[model samples]
Target: MSDSNTSDFTNPSSFILQGIPGLEEAHVWISIPFCTMYVIALLGNFTILFIVKREPSLHEPMYYFLCMLASTDLILSTSILPKTLSIFWFNYREIDFSACLTQMFFIHCFIAIESGIFTAMALDRYVAICYPLRHSTILTDPVVAKIGLAVVLRSGVLALPTPFLARRWPYCRTNIISHTHCEHIAVVKLACADTRLSSYYGLSVVFLVTGVDVFFITMSYAQILRAVFSLPTKEARIKTFGTCGSHLGAILAFYIPYLFSFLTHRFGHNVPLRFHILLGSVYLLVPPTLNPVIYGVRTRQIRDRLLRLLTQKGT
Candidate 1:
């Protein structure tokens, strides 16, 4: 919601040399809102981490992925907020090449991991719901460990090429990134050379990661649906579906906006920049804040634990 203001043309700061995107006026309305959300995201994630660490009962696969998601969400929040807030408050919009890449790497890395973790979470839910009898055997420590490792490694490897490939480009002119954060496509737009390869590579990575991930997610949910249908009573069916309500809510919130942002960028870049920015911002901002409330506060157990912990500290 903020733009760098100190882009001095006379001596374009080291960061300004790469051609700055026009820093549109800052959204004073959102600067503090996002900042507050940043704090909430951090605290929420840390609470999940603490709960998982302290409660041995929660050390299962489902909570494990939830902890991982919390961590990734915290990292995601931190990666973007500093720059965005800086631009909003200090108008110090300049970002060095190294800083930009650093920002880009963390943002995408966390995002990739988030995507992978969500898929893993979907599988966990699937195993728990569809194969309840064998859930423990199906998702053991070693198996979950391997899944975690694979998720991290896959995301890291896939995101590796983005920065590596983008760095090779000779950025001749425009560098001002329109959005609050340095997203991959937006940053790549600054490159002066042929972006066809880079764009293709980026899309290929998305398809390879998100496409496969979403397919698996769908499959897992399908199994869940079938399994739920086999249940006898109305209450049983409702209970089975209840377990996934928060997760489904989170998935919809995360994916719908992401697709919209991607499509708006691909086909409607000419549309009002604010529209794109708004959609993009909602995706980034809402998920983190809403996730804890949706997934944690809505759950009786987690809510009780959180409230009990808060009450303990109130003294």
Candidate 2:
């Protein structure tokens, strides 16, 4: 090969994304459903934001936390799906190195924020269920704002390192990323350098964020269950449990697929490439798509408010 050919192979200026490698012929067909999901997620989350902003009745702690959740979901899905659709619909697969890192940073950061927000929501439920009278005083507007800020900062600071570390590592060859989006570990693996530290750091960040959030959320729900069972009447128990149903569903929608993706990617190396990519995409896409539906159907207040808003807009 000539020096130019060697140079082109060795140090390409941009990376090509594999994007479901063997499904090359199906990209357009696959993009149709994904585009639908992205649309639903955007509309759902934006409606939540709109309802929260317009309804004074929803200006309390629970809805405030929900607003945080909706906002995070919006950012998360927006960060990922647009670029993915461009790849599928436009076949524009070239992503610059800096842009790739930037995407990786936002994706991981919002994921951390998503986990943290869910944990916060669990804590909110615990407070409201286990200690109703103190709930207002405990999660007052100022306190809720502070908690929201803390969750953002915590996720941001922790996730900031992963992309930076990856960017600084040398990549002397093979600029093709093996997935649809620039996932941190996937991109890191492409680097031609010792990535043990980066790998461990990524694992640690995941465990630290998701692990702690999951632990706290589980404990909160356990306490909530205990408190519900202790209710003096079956009616009270039913009401309390009903209130928690939406949150529980949202949690399952997110964590179950998320854990499956994480485990399969990190440990299930024997898994098919398509399965890994599909699972990861599902993990990212499903929660944002379903969370609004869960909340809208289950939370009577949001459902009623949304109906009213739509009715008003219709006439």
Candidate 3:
């Protein structure tokens, strides 16, 4: 599987995706778990959405934010898994230049959106725990809607430039992307022209979005912890902490692997490309697969609703 043409072109007709450079032999086996996770992600997130929408009691600001998170996870996992599975199962890896860019945009855009939702969730928790009396007033339905709109806009506006930037470069070097999907740097690095600006811009967007969100989350949690500890009774403190456990788990599930993959991509020069690719793919799936489960297990309302639904179906 070599490039169909070796000559220079502003844009190749399509880019050949090499599923995972060093793990071609294990692709079928790998597809099993990837496909399984995709199914789980779909089922879990959709269940969350359905439960949240149907149960009027679950329509609080917290559940609203959870719905947003679920939707983002659905998009984020979907943008990559279908194509990835195609490559794995059928060896169908050629992606049109435009399609590739579209995938890249959606993937990155939703990632930022997901991060924003996490931040919003943190704020929701912070208000619920720290400013208990004003929580409802602070996160009214209109405010939540506005926040959701802002999150989508911020992520879309920031990621919108990525495709245009990548398209501007003459990709005369080769049309083969080393990783599973058309990642920003993976595609841009194939350009025969200078890619410093694109690389720097991508880096800046990561820092700008992730850095700011992280700072806010940290500050929110710090205040939350203080408020939780200041409660008069042990039961009050335990109950307050319980409310946030799922959110903390979801946050860790997303950020830890994401940062690891990002750092490995940019700085882990000695790290194997296959390891990085696998981690990147897993990170995309893990949060989506776990978020619903974490929330269901940790949130009494969700868990009760979910169990009741299951029991009804069984009966």
Candidate 4:
């Protein structure tokens, strides 16, 4: 522990992260699954990016959005996993203040960006299904590029305040975070100063990003469902719905755990601290780990291309 003298307390040299309160003995055992998920997330997202980029057949708006999602997943998972593993494996738990903020920013920024991408993907599917003739014209290459840019910009700008807000507070209290990573709320709670503004801003950003995205996604799917049912044939309806299955799965994967963790942290007093921390850690891992697999298995184009590449390698 550092000195609690006024100057030292105000701006500590580094903060210690106590990974998962009450789970100290099982940190090593717990890390096995986290490490495996991280590795799979890395490989799966990279594979998605590679296949999407190399295959000309995949040079479309949907695939482009998928590539963006993959890239975001890579960033989101990478932002937290290495440090978490270090904490679990080697007990290297000290994180510099600036680096902690950086990690926090990336984690939240990309999460918002990923939610935006999911909305964009929903829009892509909606346009493709409902207005097939206009899909290309509505979402041209330049349009897709602009959407990608907007998603990144929106998330980055919204998340930019988190670290600054956190930094303004003086940490007269202890500088030990009780989780594996420097989540904004967890880090800010250590401050002796009023953190209500920071907490409100964080909550507002979550609603602005995720709440709005979810509404749009739901509306898009509603329109899509209407259009699918209007189709003349049952087979056509099923086929159209099939195209959306992967996106739906990906959305559920990302948001379900995310919302659970958020709610647990904010309101679930009865929830065990270890369970919340573990859920928080797993919340970051599960989406990235599952997204590529969902798309690869449920999406025929990606699945075929992946199989072809694997077949070639096997031969």
Question: What lDDT does model 4 reach?
Answer: 0.93
RMSD values for the candidates in order, in angstroms, are 3.8, 2.3, 1.3, 1.6
Report the lDDT of model 4 for residue 30: 98
Once fitted onto the true fold, the runs of candidate 1 whose alpha carbons sit more than 4 angstroms away are 1-26
Lowest summed lDDT window (length 10), candidate 3: 1-10
lDDT of each structure? Answer: 0.77, 0.87, 0.92, 0.93
Top-scoring candidate (lDDT): 4
TM per model?
Answer: 0.90, 0.95, 0.97, 0.97
lDDT of candidate model 3 versus the reference: 0.92
lDDT of 4 at 149: 96
Q: Candidate 2's residue-wise lDDT over 107-169, tens digit each?
A: 899999999999999999999999999999999889988889999999999999998898777
Clashes of each: 4, 0, 0, 0
Whole-model lDDT, model 2: 0.87
Cα shift from native, residue 14, model 1 (Å):
4.3
The positional error of residue 17 in candidate 4, measured at the CA in angstroms, is 0.5
Question: For residues 1-315, could you state the per-residue lDDT of candidate 4 as single tens digits?
Answer: 552323348876688889998989999999999999999999999999999989998999999999999999999999999999999999998999999999999998999999999999999999999999999999999999999999999999999999999888998778788899998888998898889999999999999999999999999999999999999999999988998999999999999999989998889999998898899999999999999999999999999999999999999
Question: Which pairs clash in model 1?
Answer: 4-93, 19-175, 20-176, 21-176
